[model samples]
Target: MSATGAIPVPPGKAGKAGKERFDAAGRRVLLVCVAGGFTTLIDQSVLNTSIPALRESLHAQPAHLQWIVAGYSLAFGLALIPGGRLGDVRGRKWFFVGGLALFTVVSLLSATATEPWALVVSRLLQGAGAGLVNSQMIGTLQDVFQGQLRARALGMYAVTGGLAFALGPPVGGAVLAAVGPEYGWRLTFLLNVPFGLATLWLAARHLPRPRPSARDADLDLVGLLLVGALTLALMLPFVQPPGWAGWLGFAVAAALLLGALAWWQRRFARAGGHPLIHPALTRSAPYALGTAVAMAQFGSSLAAGLVLAMFLQDGLGLSPLGAALVALPSAVAMGFASAVAWRVVARFGRRTVTAGMTGSALTMLTGGLVALWAPAGPLPWLLALLQLLGGASIGLMGASNQAFVLRHAPAEAAGVSGAILQMAQRIAAAVSISALSGVYLRATGGGGGHRAAFAWASGVCAAVAALAVLASVLAGRATAREEAAREESALAVTSNEPARESTRASG
Candidate 1:
């Protein structure tokens, strides 16, 4: 109905105006989400290079140091699924705010802690908070964006995460250099405080209110418990690698827990409840293949990063700061590549993923050859150049792979799907980094030289990357086959329609 003497706007123009307004709002929201993601991810690795400083400052034992690293990750992996479900059921706005507030408070506590136990506990609580906020961030992106915009938004998200990981070491090293060891480590925790508070404010102002769930919504507690336990079982050995005997025990426990989880999910769904992970998601070919690709690439790529840092410091005798600087190109290139990755995805579909994985594999293999034979004077420069390409390759693979996998998630279960995909990547990084470290250490200890160790580790990463390439290829072929089948069915229906109409007319 129009007001008297006023004309009604054309429907198409009105719709375009509405869509433009919505998109502007979504972009503002995305900035807040990406900031939250960047904060937590940077914290994940920022402490690694500062471990020595922490040990000296806190008077910590080796065991305490180990816990300081392992505990945070343990809590993070445990919290993801449950946290995601909470956001799904409850509103994301309050949950995201509460989580960020918790993270901020805990960061302050960590900075002030005088005892090792206090710091350890603070880290655990902080990880839980981060896990909670991160789930909502991923969930919000899933809710707010669609089509190519969704892919591009997720690409930016990936860029931040990758950049955070790569930059953490350098960031920490710089802080330590700026301040003496006595205070350097404390400042790292303190750094999160200001950024967290700012992001929390933006989130409170800009994030959307969550839609209410049904009054009878079920959380599937049993499924949540199973998931948490299974995650611990699968992750513990990798984070703190054990003897072969202990490894066997954890592996067996993980397998049994997994079976139990699958059974429970199905039974719960049959009984008219929502499973934490939908059965259809587990059965989805695209999801399965995409996950495999993510795990392989994420684990191996991170392993290569860790190994490269070591090679620079140990193999090349560069200082920590120097090593970090040499590796900076890779991180910078990753962000650059991620910024434009969606354009390639628009053109190539899954082939973009395949191309990226192929590039990564080549980069790793080339790194190995260069490490073994490059002149000492030029080695660092040459390796840094290669790493630049490596980072871009990863950016392309990660952004495309994440968008593809998450799109397959049912709208109702988007949070769970994103959590699961991230979970796989985290677990894979733990295992692969541990395994690759052993390879490097073994070679170095046996007098095989750091050059050989770098070569060996790079070879392993390249092999895993090749596996990712294979998985991406298979996934793309499956999609093509499904599209062809759908087209054939549609054409058949159209061709038969005219004949059926004539017969009806004659009758």
Candidate 2:
């Protein structure tokens, strides 16, 4: 026995035991994280398919109808940073289970919603719960796995997310069709109940509880409040009726809220308590640039879907079922792409990012041109091609950017870093959808001019893709620097290690 009241074992045997324990823990953590991700998929996809049914049943107007979707998205985005911080401050297991419980309860409430407002509020709560669970997943993975294994786990995580996105719409539609509209939308939300309960039970029984590290800090409540206020202000314009006064008020609030939030974060950081986002992490070139790319890519993809769905239904006179079928190829492509993202990243590094973004930009530009010149001709094939191209691009850029961010983040700050990235993405999605919807509304003369609206929406996609290209360029440079630093560190460590002969002789 060692002096510290511990038993010392043979080095080989100890290493074997530790390895076995680590492998077991890693598998358990992966299972829990993947389960959480699956639920999030259900929540997101179910709502998307049920939007029309929700509108019909609740008698929701266009502006109000957007809330059915945007409400959940907004809440989910706003809560991400705080959720991550909570996981860091508390333990991951509690946050994970607590989030799942909140989600399950809210999902039930959503299923029971008879009024539009009831559904909206329930969706928001559901989003909040999802935010808590999702923001902790990457951090939990980092805590459980390391090196190549971590990369593989992340790849699998991406694959799971892709599968959820790909399957969500069709499944939601199938459930709705089977049960009838009265029960269809409700089932989408209610379906999450069993899955959530199962996750909670399995996690409690099998997941290893991680101890709070000494390095963990207290929650940054002030920073969190400020950021939350800023996000809410930004999303308010999208949800409210459009008027000059309303727009102006929201703009002013957003500016003030963001300014105050920035100042408070700086103040908090200087005061010794951790800020909601670690300044050092955000200040890193890779982190900052990677976040920008992530935001634009995800935001643009979501906006494209929203706008395209509208165009298909209104302009092409396609049914919701028909449009979803047309869109299936892209979604399927995205799923396949996610599965292979690890191989792509390992082979091409950041070049994969640049290429993907460039491809997306070209695809959007081409789609817009084609739609404008030939709106009625070859509609299905044109859309099919566009979706395939877009899906491939999203798969490459989305997973690659995530890997890039994780590679650069310090292990301890993974939670907060992921939170910030997700925050940017949410804000971007909210703002883009609002702005694009406005553009489509104006172009179509308030929903009557479908052709013009589709053209305008295509234009927005092009602009977003262009912005992504710029982000890709910056990401490329940052990746180069990171690779150089890694090489230098490796060399330094190798130089400092004792000679092999000397080590062997001493042993």
Candidate 3:
């Protein structure tokens, strides 16, 4: 009804107006969500450029340096599932704000820290906050968007991330070079302060608060502990240069803790309790396969970047800014590739991912060969070209992989799925960086073995890419079959519902 007590606007017009309003709201929400993630991404890139500067200024040991790089990732990976569950049980709004606030404070701590251990501890805490922030951002997206809108939002998420990757190196290098070596690394962390506050303001103003869960439901604290313990045990050996015996001990502990986590969560949920992450997610073939692929992609890529950074800065004597310039072309190509990724996914499905993995494998192999023999002057261009190809491979697969994983996840477990995806990536990153460092250290004999180190790292990346190809193929087949079964089941239920209702009314 109109205010004049006459016929309302046409039905089509009304719907169109409503849709436009909804879209406006969605866009604002998406910006807020992406902003939260942007801070973390910038922090990641800036820190990478500052690695050598930190080493020199703090007089940090090899182990200390590794912790500085890997600690936050380890902590973030461990906290993600539990943090997501907390948001599901509590309200996401407060959790998001809390996480951002914590992140800001810790960023300051990390920036101001005078000692190596202090910086490491602050980074660990910052990672935990980041895990919370990411879980909430993803959950918020799932809550607000549906169908085509959801797909677009997720694609935009990937694009924003790609842009961040492109921006990180140049931003870090510029800041580092401007501030000089002593204080440049600190500025990287400090830069997050304003962005964090602004994001928090937008989130509070625009994002809706998630409804709290039922009173009886809560996160499985014991399961979270077990998962955390398992993560810590698995990560410890990697960061600290633990030998074979130490690795064996930690591996055993990790296995035991993992088994315990599974058993506890199963029994808890059987008693009508909420598990940290639903066991059904584990049973989802698409999620499992996609997660494996994501792990490989992140691990190989992060390790490759770290190894290359080392080669450029330490081995080749290039300044941070110079190295960033050399790496700029790949990042630019990646941003462009990511912009069109959703279209590729819509058209090609899982085959696109397989192709990307194949490209990744070839590029890494080529990079390895180049590292071994290519001359210095033309070497940067060749490496840039290989990196550009590799970046495209990553952009093409990553968005689709995430979408596929989320598509199969239950609506109530949105937070869990997001956490699991991120956790895999971060864990892979932490472990891979450590492993690559070991390879570099051994190959260089404590000096300059840039070529050998790069060759070895690229080989590992190629192997991972090959495995990813197999995983993506298997997952695509499984997901197609699963979708078909679901459609049939839905149709069956729909057909039977009318007859059942008729029978009930007659009775």
For residues 1-507, write the lDDT of model 1, one tens digit per residue. Answer: 111111245777866644633366897899998999999888867776666667678888644654566566556655676777777777688888988899899999998989999998998899888878888888888788876566567767877888898788778768877886678789988999999989988998889978867545477778778876876676566445588999999989999999999899999999988787787777766677888999899889767876776678668877656666777887788888777876676556677788889999999999999999989999999988987888888877787788777765656566578888876676576556656766775577578899989998999999999999999887776666655676789899999999999999999
TM-score of each: 0.85, 0.85, 0.88
Expressed as tens digits, the lDDT of each residue in 22-130 for candidate 3 is 4677888998989988887667766877788888898887677777777777777777776777777776888988998999989999999899999989988998898
Error of 2 at 26 (Å): 2.5
Off by over 4 Å in 2: 1-25, 179-182, 210-217, 241-249, 375-377, 410-412, 438-447, 481-507
Q: Which residues of candidate 3, in runs, are more than 4 Å off? A: 1-22, 209-217, 445-448, 483-507
Q: What does candidate 2's lDDT look like per residue over 285-346, in tens digits?
A: 77787788888877776667776766775567665566677677777888777767656765
Please give the lDDT score at residue 154 for candidate 2: 79
Q: What TM-score does prediction 1 earn?
A: 0.85
Worst 10 residues of 3 by lDDT: 1-10
**Global CA lDDT computed for model 2:** 0.73
Better of 2 and 3 by TM-score: 3
Clashes of each: 0, 0, 0
